[model samples]
Target: MERKNLVIVGGGSTYTLGIIMSLIEEKENFPLQNLTFYDTDADRQEKIAKATEILLSEHYPELESFSYTTDKAAAFADIDAAFVQIRTGGLAMRELDEQIPLQHGVVGQETCGAGGMAYGLRSIKDMIDLVNDIRYYSRDAWILNYTNPAAIVGLALKREFPDDLRILNICDMPIAIMKSYADLLEKDVWELVPEYFGLNHFGWFSKLLDKAGNDLTDEIKDKIINGDFLPTDKEIANDESWIQTFRQARQMLIDFPEFLPNTYLQYYLYPDDLAKKESPDNTRARQVINGREKRVHEHCDQIIQQGTAKDIDVEADIHGVYMIRAAASLLFNLKETFVVMVENQGVISNLPADALVEVPALLTNHGPKAFSVGEIPVFYKGLIENQHAYERLVVEAYYENSYNKLLQALTLNRTIVSAPKAKAILDDLIEANKDYWPALK
Candidate 1:
């Protein structure tokens, strides 16, 4: 078997560490020839690079690894797979992440609505640069992007890159929630296959069934509404307000009875409530970010520090491991039927030809063959239309540097206030992200 070279952009990112750890644990199944880490920040990347080398050496000594500069010619050379997880700006801009949406009285999430548009504007140019670099260095390499504003990035790649360049955008929110749901149901997650669609974190599970063909949505819904479900973890549950958000959304689900909504849907589905100044403080976005994001950063810091001290634990808590497993099963083991995002190409029957829809797919050595989702609910279709338009505008704004298109994308976001407020926020965000973003007029 030929060895594969995996290149990780944004090497210092905690998510990258998680993926590396996952790969190490599954070393026997997917042995790597070489691992290369690339990041523009030398000091931060150096710390993670050293720590990763020490950790991998102690755990999986057979694989070779190195970390290098972000220079395209050096970092991307001869890569087989590239994992991208770059943040356009640093934690210094976190205030913008929180404040901008609060200014509009919305839920104020870091990766949705106004904040996400801001992020998209900044990230698009960098992502394109990296993508172009991959094509320049290794034209055949697969680019697995786990960036925020995933729908926009995916759209940009589809429009700009060659069809066979192999770009797949992913988010772990679905998998994370699915595991929690599986634990609540007392069933192995693998046994519960889900049929879901919509954009990234904003998606809903359309269908869920056990391997034996039993519908568990009702049972899960019952548990959620009754507040009988325990928190996924005590740390996450510590914030009482956050727990109530779940309870409130569960109530909404009971009322609708048509779909099971994600946590993020509250921002869109209840925009008035989420965006009202007097909208009785439910779980604010900061609470969730603090509870989840803070812990993740802490974990990464610990991993780097501990690994540097020779206390190496190369264990990864990443959903990408499951994706790799599914890919391997489909390609090597010849198993069929997994949910994946691929080109529409009549896969969804009704969705636009260029729209990237999530549906059941059959994976072979050639790649994924997406199956049709047929007709989705009217509400979902409406939501998809809004989101898809915003995403397309974002890509256009980035690729073309059209400020008007960027404003349109921001204004189109359900959580954004209106055209005027969107314009104000865009101005502020552009200034904040000047270093990362392309020059905009």
Candidate 2:
């Protein structure tokens, strides 16, 4: 077993511990010669870095080495792989991203609608720089990016680093759904396989099978139509709001009983209902801030003060461990099938061949090659194409810094169809994101 060197780029993120804990637990599968945490914010990264130190020392002290640094050159040096899940503006910017749109009676989600667009605009630049740093220091290092607004960020990476095949953009939502499906069926997730298609956060599961290859789509669909929401995967279910989001899939299935819909689709399909359901004064950001954000930081403080994580309750992310799973696949050539975003090419006949889409792909040492989805039905085809346009234009808007393109992207969003409303929203977003987004004029 050849140990590898890996770095977590956004090591300060609240989500960092879950991944680090996962790596420690799965060291047998993906042994590491060196584990490094890299973040620009010195204060923010220190807490996570301290807690990670406790975790490593308490468990895998025999491991070669572990360190956290703010220097890109030092962190990226000699790394075989880099797991990138950067929240560019952190949670504070996320609050603005979600709050601004809801103020205007629209669905305000971190990774959907106007909120996702704002996040995309802010994220594109950092993603580009991160890729460049990784390539510069570790040219062949696999940049497994699970960055938000994945469709747009991934597309930008595809365009900006066209020849960098090692950059694989992936999302965990599909696998989370699969874990939920496995829970519903009372089986281990490994025993089931799902056939899914569409864009990130905007996809559907068309087929599912057991180890014996038993068809299970209709069974899951029947459960969903009857108001059976998937049991949240163990890792994410800890968040009550996330559990609620998981349950909303029931309504989605009732409306589109032909296939299982991503929980995020609720934002687009029922923007009015979603708006009414949310509390603008305290949105998901507030929920996270008051919940996971507060708890994790406090936990890290406790671990640091106590100088040991032996007593801290660290829940393993059963399904949210997309990075670890993908790394293992690449490291060992496991040929694991996962839902990842990739250049559409010929995967979806109707969508632009150059478009980046979220479809099932097999992860190998080289990267993911998306499975062909053929042509989709008219209803989904139209919605997907329109969303694809939004993603592409947002990437262009970031690159071109064109206000017109920014507004165009907002106008095409299913949650904000009117040009006037889109303009109004864009202006407000520009005001809120003035510090983060590019100057669009």
Query: Quick one: best lDDT, which candidate?
Result: 2
**Tens digits of per-residue lDDT for model 2 on 252-347?**
788687788888888888888888888778889888888887888998999999998867887668543667978889878889888888888889
TM-score of each: 0.86, 0.97
Please give the CA lDDT of all the candidate structures.
0.69, 0.85
lDDT of 2 at 257: 79
CA lDDT, candidate 2, residue 172: 82
Kindly give the number of clashing pairs for every candidate. 2, 0
Question: Where is the poorest 10-residue window by lDDT in model 1?
Answer: 277-286
The superposed Cα distance between candidate 1 and the true structure at residue 282, in angstroms, equals: 15
**Candidate 2 lowest-lDDT run of ten:** 227-236
Please identify model 1 stretches exceeding 4 Å from their true place: 66-71, 228-249, 275-315, 326-338, 439-441
